[model samples]
Target: MENYIVIIAIISSIILFLSAVIVFVRFYRERTQFKILLGVALIVLLAGSIINVFEHTAILQSAEEFEQILSILFLPIIIFAIYESIIGEQLRTHIKSEQMFKGIFNQTFSFVGLLNSEGRILEANSTACDFIGYDNDEYKGVFFPETRWWKHSAEEMKNLEGAIKQAGQGKTVRYETTNIDKDGKIHYVDFSLKPIHDSRDRLIYLIAEGRDITEIKSTRLELEKHKKNLEDIVEKRTLELKTANEELQLKNETLYEKNTIINEQNAKLVSTLIDLKETQTQLLQAEKMASLGVLTAGVAHEINNPLNYIVGAYEALKQKDTHSGDEEAEMLLDAIKTGVDRVAGIVKSLNQFSRDTPAENEECNIHEIIDDSLVMLHSRLNNKIEIHKNYFKDSFVTFGNVGNFHQVFLNILSNAEQAINEKGKIWIKTTKNDNYLIITITDSGKGIEKDAINKITDPFYTTKDPGEGIGLGLSIVFGIIKEHGGRLEFESEVNKGTTVTVMLPQKGMKHE
Candidate 1:
């Protein structure tokens, strides 16, 4: 039994040594008193075990004695651990509270200054330094009233002195004060000062804060001036209105006679406007008929050529000997059908161009309108003009009476054809620019002189020999483009060419 006791003591001593080593490691890592106490307890147990096993056995041989010894050592260690925990908690709380105070003080947008009880600045935050245009070193230990911020206005400085005195008495004071900056520029601030006291009820410092309110001050003054002006205007307008009422009552009979005259004049004016509108529309119709009249010879030629082709093809086929698997008949029929379709297209274009009533406004591609106009002028320009088309592939969409667009293109193109007495090239370019479609028609022709360019689109103004053109074509075009919220501009130099630019807005577009 004594030998067994020795072996148990040796095992117990090993556990105590390991526990002491772990406790000391924790003590070094945590720097806590609890770990130190745990380390000392483990070491004391390890020493008791070693002495029982190697030196003496009677004292630590019993479990009860070992437990009693551990209890005696652990009581004081527990108390120390509790005490150390409380102190650590207090230190952590103090650190967090200081961080919070510093965050609020430095990060606030308002100017904040910590002033000693004597109203001298002890510390100024970044905002305060920036606002005053001074470094921290410059303002430290400087009296609030002695700073450069109050240099411009004595009244503002007086107000500041009163606030400081109130704050020094442990009373909070708030007032507006004008502050000057490094450049002596005046600014208003919503200024406030409050007394801070220590736990012993002694004044520690004064916290001065100010938010910029210069714009607010200016606005208030403007509002007051406006109010005064409005009151004066109301009084003056009341007097004028009272006098005018009396005059109005006296002139009732004269006003009644004048109204009667005005009504009659208005009726005549409205009638004249209606007549003018009808005359204007009639002139447009007459111009379309005149265009058709010019195309009559071309239309006849267009129709006759196709008809003659069909006749010649038909006669040639009839005379040919019929044979099985002959390609001759099929080829002649295809030629005849093509010619027939060409004739049919010319007639259809003529019918569309000769509409008796104006077409309603519709969404249309300007390129399609240009194509139809070119189709109408086809016979006239077939071999004479080389047409260069640079049209927008996506198409420029605009809202307007499609017929009016047709008329506009027809008129411009007709002028172009006439301008070029011989063979030439005509370039038609369509492009987009910021809610507008720009169409540029450039014709290599005999351009008008600078003096005549101004009068080109004028009514009844013709550069053509008197009978050659009535000169209403471009005038009508100008009126149409203008009514569509668009403009027509011409750039020309004699014998070089003329470029007619048309700008049409794409928004809120409709026929007028």
Candidate 2:
């Protein structure tokens, strides 16, 4: 029996020590007052368990009493923390709802009041209380017509009573009436009374809403006075126009006869202009082609010289079969030659691609293309960014080189993915504005600084690492947009996000 008690005491101390360590670690991270109190209580319990393992009667009894004191002090706090952790969000939501209701009820400029169906004022907003110059408590449970907001006259009060009665019967009543403020000032107000029903459709309260319309009433009266003055001026203008019309009619006949001769002469000029325009168009086309050929040749000649250098280096290495060469050197020579040849091939291919007819356009939906772009980047979006798509249902179709459009979307989405560090959001909105289709791609990522934003689309300018990008993506997108007669723009804030907006015409540009 002594051995068993010792073993049980050891097990208890182990469990209490573990619990104390966990609580201390939690307090270290959180640094909350409740955690502080809870940590102290756990330490006391752990101390009591350790003392019990020794079997010292005097110390053990004192430790147990101290443990009881700590429990009494901290149990309520630990229980409160547990409750908060479980349902804190629900409590926060309820508090927010109360704040919103109070803001709308107390902070509005319009005079608003709630009344019992018998027309007794139950509550009034601050605006109503201030407007009538009465305390909120002063107006409680008072009849609406008898309140200070209404006039002192019997007839006015009777009319207000009638409106209130009508509102109590589920009918809305509205009228322009004279209301007396606290200082015996009369003001005209557009007042409305309506009945409010409970969830069960039982009439509960009458709502009184009002707007002061004294200035509007004054403006209407002024306009009524100006009506005759405007009519007199209009009559005078009509008499003058009548005399002018008679004289103008004779002059118009003379001018019309002269215009007939001019029209015949203009027809010959217009025909001559059309022929001249066609001739000019042909000459311009010829000039454009010649300039394009010269430019392409110059670019190819300049870039292809390095290609020959690499090829010559490889050939020299190959011919020196007797010379001993390191394997790394030989392998590098071969790689350089291969890379140069690919460059030469791409240059030649570009010249050919320009000469060949552009790929045929197809009717593609803008939203569908966006969807495809998102699919291609799903791996990146899986854990990092949430996609929000806002697109209309009806197909927004346009004649497009679908491959080119696909590249454009992919480039933009990839840039967004690279820009964000970790978790963020991307918002893509598509809408047709006037005759153009507008697509906006916005991301919550580290944004381009203002100085760098203008330089982003420039050739060979980049903010990416050496192996990550060569900086030609945005420039290519700019060219693609220009070919389609569209516009591209960017809005950004540092550490917030960037929004790329592209506007393309409904009808795509003609292929060059």
The model with the greatest lDDT is 1
Q: TM-scores across all candidates?
A: 0.42, 0.36
Best by TM-score: 1
lDDT string for model 2 (155-273, tens) is: 78899899988987899999888877777878888999989999998999998998888889999989988997899999999999999999999999999999999988988977875
Off by more than 4 A, model 2: 1-100, 153-156, 170-175, 194-197, 235-512
Worst 10 residues of 2 by lDDT: 350-359
Predicted candidate 1 versus true structure: per-residue lDDT over 77-126, tens digit per residue: 76776676787668888999999988888889888989999999888878
lDDT score for candidate 1 against the true structure: 0.81
Clash pairs of candidate 2?
none
